[model samples]
Target: DPSHIAGKREYLYEISQKAFDMGMEGLMIESHYNPSLALSDANQQLTPADLSKLLDKLVIRYQYANNPEFENQLELLRNRIDSIDSELLEILASRAEIVRQIGKYKKEHNVTALQINRWSQLMENRIKLGEKLNLSEVLIKTFFQLIHEDSVRMQTEIMNS
Candidate 1:
């Protein structure tokens, strides 16, 4: 998570400490050099050096806890969770990029930006598929809502551009 411009490191350290005290295994943070050049979250991206410093502190604190089995379990779970999250993010990014392309095509062809009927059909099919896969209807609906909203926004941006 991002914090105010100044004291971000202190703020994050406090947060990490609190989380640790509350029995959290760890945290996930984003970092970049020359954060000003970042495409997303430019203002919040920490420098590599700063990120390393934070990690060092976290490592020391974690080791001081002296629960090797707990640490190992946390590491394994975190790695697997991160792997799944990365794959999901990749898929979403690819989908968004394709939506942008579709918007460009629509603009060049003078097509309308939205097709409500098609979207409805897509949602219905996805819901059925989710059910077949043993997913809750509510979860399926919520997921599709988020995906559809993002797709629409992406396509709209391309069309306007």
Candidate 2:
């Protein structure tokens, strides 16, 4: 879903301008017909007619400019990223099942729901590996935090009996 802070058109405009200045081709705006009837993002979705009007206004001000080489490079990078993203999703699904197994085992062993120390160690090791692979530390940390939180919740549910 696309999101921008509301009641801050100036801020959003500045951000969009910065992206253009940084060589982005254009913005990918989400538009829908009868946004009020949307199942999701009812508040954010714009009617198709309104969106068209907005795009017309924006197109007059924004020029389409890009280095020819940039498109090829971007396509190559996108392909590589898509491949890795598929693998990552598979691995995450496997990890979720493994967490479920761990929850069951912990129940049998009468262990406490969460092993925070072990989770901390796991995160530290993962961040180290991520660093070796050139991933941003902040991104790695945030990913692990969400995964750990969800895994703990799963474990908690199993332990509650």
Candidate 3:
């Protein structure tokens, strides 16, 4: 994300760990001779000494692609994910219902689906909340934009039909 000063580095490390754990094909890191005096992003830059220390601490996990235990655990996780997906679908459906109601009101009042001011407020508020919740601002913004686009599309259809 590299967007926020506080969360960026921590979030970077976290995703790097996950990527390696999930058996990513390649990994790269930047290390400087002296991070404190680095030319750019000094705070995020790691000295070779610091990088070595971190590399020493990291445990390169096995892929476990064919391990029976991994398979079993994967199955259990998939089941849990299935459950969560069901719940998420229900929630999204409810949101869609609300969107439809809003569309109906907007249509009756001859209002446009696009509300730039409300969208701007949502972008700011949701992005701040997402950062507080340890989510990348880009991630939250992209997600909101997607849902907002879909809502707009459906609302437009409702108004037209």
Work out the TM-score per prediction.
0.54, 0.56, 0.59
Give stretches of model 3 more than 4 Å off: 1-64
Ranking by TM-score: 3, 2, 1
Instruction: Estimate the lDDT of model 2.
Output: 0.73
**Over the stretch 1-161, how does candidate 2's per-residue lDDT look in tens digits?**
12354322323344555566666676654556776676765665566776665555552233443777877887899999999999999999999999989999999999987787998799899999999999999999999989989998898898786
- After superposition of all CA atoms, the RMSD between model 1 and the true structure is 13.9
Backbone clash count, each prediction separately = 0, 0, 0
Looking at model 3, the pairs that clash are none
Question: Which residue pairs clash in candidate 2?
Answer: none
Compare the candidates by lDDT and give the number of the best one: 3
Best prediction by TM-score: 3
Give the residue spans of candidate 2 off by over 4 A.
1-73
Tell me which of candidates 1 and 3 scores higher on TM-score: 3
List lDDT for all candidates, in order.
Answer: 0.77, 0.73, 0.79
